[model samples]
Target: MLHGAGGSGEQVLPYFTALGDRLSMAVVAPTAQQPVQTTSNLDLAGIFGSRFRMPRWDLAGRDFPLAALRWALTELGADPNRCVLAGVSMGGLATWNLSMRFWHSFAAAVPLNGALSIWESFGTDARTRALLPNTLPLPLFVVHGGKDERISPEFDRESVRTLRDLGHQEVEYVEVPEGAHGLDTLGLAEGSPLFRQLERRLCRASRTDQSASISHRANEDTHGRAHWVGLDGITPQRTAEVHARWTAADRVDIEASGARRVALYLRGDRLSPGDMVTVTVNGVVSPVRFTPDLATVHHTFQNTVDPGLVAEQVIRLDVPQPPGDEPAEPTNRTRGRDAETI
Candidate 1:
């Protein structure tokens, strides 16, 4: 779980101690890496605050915050598939940001009184719009106060509506009519909507790899892979996307945009353990040998630190272009190495 602005992991322990005990779960919260020196809330500007001196998640980058959370999980040996991320205020925004970017890392997310709409432009929309269909399953429980003055409740309401309109079915938005910006108070209640959502979603393993179809988008290599699929050789400063579907017992259809390489991390799911599998990239068709490498399993587990997500085999395929197609323009940015198993 992440803490709000100007807040520490220790400061939010009391909020979840009783709930964690009741649920038989351990709560691990990590402090943000950067601290903003500030005297009053007024000193901060916009949603992040001005000249912020309080410790908070860095919205501009993903390395520090992600590394911190994963390090804590690694130390505790926490089950990534069963973990749920919940946060309040600025932390609430961090929850949304991290969960969306790394959907396979957590089962569900609860963001209380977060500035959902404001962060939409900053991180959510650009990073997720292309993969919304794939991301819709990562359940969300959102709460906001109708009387919130610091972060308007109407913002969350509008964002929720937009998500629903975009076909996200598992999102739940709750508004406390009489509450204010400090809706973290409600999150402490056992009967609150956020807690109930966690009760229903937490502790359940997220079977992201079992899906028949998968879609993913990424602007950077570090955030490229999702579920059992990955996009590689993406152009710098360009977002790459890939969609794959099991069309038949032994056939997989794949389409990619803004990418030159794609990989299928396979398990025993319809196509694995077989001698040969048919792969269709764009419209080109080919037969590829299916081989499960033990080394791959070890390497994947080492990277993800989750046995449930390890793939039995990986099939690397180059994105095919139509005949007579012109090559893309070259850029100064160098491409990263091949994608690792998700």
Candidate 2:
């Protein structure tokens, strides 16, 4: 479990109580790294008043909360394959970002009254808009308020549309007619439909074996270029694929089998004049055309290798830096901002 901006683990403890005793599961509510003295009802009209903002979960780039979650699961001896991630407000935004990058890590996800992307909240760029269709086909239970003015409900609706368009079949979206940003006000009570859906997903995961799964790891270089690594499952029959949202100077490495048709999805809207992508499969290099939008690059090798043999394929994108003298600084929009109230 995670808390919203300006909220602590103690603040969200009541949400755990609402689950009741029907679900017997170990829960871990990790507190944020930074704390705020302001409560949920703090006034935000004055700019220089007694205002505070807690540290965000770092969903966009660093993903510090994900590392903490892994440590928590290890310490508690909990089965991460059967885990469920639920959050509210800014925590809800982290839910979407984390789950999308680590699709196979959780059985299901529940995000309440949250914006799907940074584009929905502050503004839009090519990178943010490109992340829309990459929502994985995980069983998602979304709850929002029709009267929420802080974060528009249209973000949830558009997210649902993008998920459905990307072939997500098991999606449940519920809208409270008169609810606000609070979980209780959103109708996630003891016998609510959201709980029922979560229970069903938990039951289904209990009967399946998900020991072999694919996971993604992301890192950024000192120059702000992103790097992604996708590890396929151990089983031979599973299809190997990599999905990534990249800037111009990003690099990706995928471990795949020769028998599998590797599908690579690359999203970049700021392709330079001489930008080119080099795909190296088992040391055979080939240059591919770089489009100004999303591109699906597919490669199938005729030399069939053993299904168990995994080979590392490299994709190096050579993009010249933009001709500007100003250095870019990373910014966190969710931090130091006033949070929506109940």
Candidate 3:
């Protein structure tokens, strides 16, 4: 797994620490070459903008991810192709860039809230947009949050949309509600354990075989679906009165494990008998069927986000609200691990 900009290796370590203890897969996260000094403790946008100076996954960023993969290969006595590249934000950009360049070098690619803006950062005129969705057979999982402010949901949407539009079947997209953009929130959240499960699914003894399939127990695709359902529409004043705030556009409190079928529930007052709604998983837009039973309504989505990006993607599902047994509201969980809430 990889870390985000101005972040360190420790970011992606804990997710696999337990797995390393059992399967003994060595977990590695290298530091960034340059660190931007925060001004007035408010420079996420500026520093991140600077990251685009080069292709996100270009040599400057790829070096560490590559090094870590090399180290894992050496320690495991396995080929480099058996590795998985994953990261968040800038690191995620590196993950995508490296994975594309060395598609055949690894077993799978996982990028959490990453983009292809490296060329913009360096003032390069290369056709990066054209180069994306290139000919690569490796699987990828891309995660994002719907409410992400710094990177915005459109960034993740466009990435997945392009790949899907290009007809690349190996990609998967996941969006979470109320997911934070900060690394600290993502690294510690219990929902973030999805990474551990994802790694196990993509693990291979050797990276030499292209046709080999890594096993993923969490293979429930939620593609081709979308929906807009909120609680009677949450109100901030009402939340504070009850020690709560509106989440998921003011409704929903459930966890998603990519079930083959996703059941959505809406508050009674949220939608009427004739209300119409739809869902967007990844970028596949699809309307949902309403089965109102009280103030609750729900739907199941198949293959919305790319699957490859989900399991192996270094998702830092935001934890803006306190981390507890309760999951973030569904619609708000768009950014995956890139949430400032986490």
Candidate 4:
């Protein structure tokens, strides 16, 4: 499974807990081999990654990521023939590219509200056609938001139409109800009919695969928030880290934005010095900082969750435990940030 733009497997996992259970599949959310800078949330464009950006999926990514995926599959002892490839945003684009490049690898491919190019179509000459015909049909699970104006849901329709025009036999298209560009954790929990359809597709291949439980399920909270299927309940986890002395001065606001990668920002969390400082947020930790003048720093962390689950939203920042004085209560703040549902 891959995440959207600005997301590593880590950041996007929480938004897909239900998908995990529905598929009854073990998941691999390896971090991107290297960070890619992107600005657009759609088409998985990175705002500040040095490693990748949109329009670079053509044999243009680092080798390590694919190598790592191979290693991971081997470690899982998974049968590559039965593997399903699914991703959102840039990851979706990656999956599309992989399907074309490694045509024989995946059993099924799912690209959620993403753009894909086979590259083979670009060339008009005979050699190019011989090298890459319109290509083979891929069983697809195409999902998108009917109202996602950012990239426009119509693009998804066009993709499906293209596949049908190419004589593809199997194509499953799902349009989320009242959906938008960044359908994050809340949107998932708000409940979508898409879940049942997704589950059907996930398990469609293997009535025999029932013995394998790729993931677990979580009980719904009072408000209907769902966690991971196999990794149920909130795991009260804690760790320690230092913070910018400057963060003490800036009021940080966390925004879920209804998409993966919880975003944290402070008007001026930057310290007087231009140094990288360590800080923790929402019991999750990160290490990046800015100078006093560069007060605005957005730290986005990803997690996968069952989109339909509901729970209290809180963020805990680990402030340094000052030696002489009593340690401050773990700073607690609440925000509405969410992991993307795509």
Report the number of clashing residue pairs per model.
8, 0, 79, 54
- Writing each residue's lDDT as its tens digit, candidate 3 over 95-180 gives 76555444545667777766655334333213334335432356777776555665655666777787788787677777766666
Residue-wise C-alpha lDDT for candidate 1, range 104-146, written one tens digit per residue: 7777778888753353433344433343344577887788887
- True-structure RMSD, every candidate: 5.6, 13.1, 20.1, 21.9
Better of 3 and 4 by lDDT: 3
> Native-vs-model 4 lDDT?
0.42
- The digit string of per-residue lDDT tens for model 2 on 132-246 reads 4434447787888998876678888888877788677777778889988776687656777766766666556521232122333222121011122333221121222333332
lDDT of each: 0.66, 0.50, 0.44, 0.42
Q: Which candidate is the best by TM-score?
A: 1
Ranking by lDDT: 1, 2, 3, 4
lDDT for 155 (candidate 4): 55
| Top lDDT model | 1
What TM-score would candidate 2 get against the native?
0.58
Model 2 poorest ten-residue lDDT run: 300-309
Error of 4 at 130 (Å): 12
Backbone clashes counted, model 4:
54
Better of 1 and 3 by lDDT: 1
What ranking of all candidate models by TM-score puts the best one first?
Answer: 1, 2, 3, 4
Cα deviation at 23, candidate 2, in Å, is: 2.2
User: What is the RMSD, in Å, between candidate 3 and the native fold over all Cα?
Assistant: 20.1
Candidate 1 residue pairs that clash: 36-52, 36-53, 36-54, 37-53, 44-49, 44-50, 45-49, 45-50
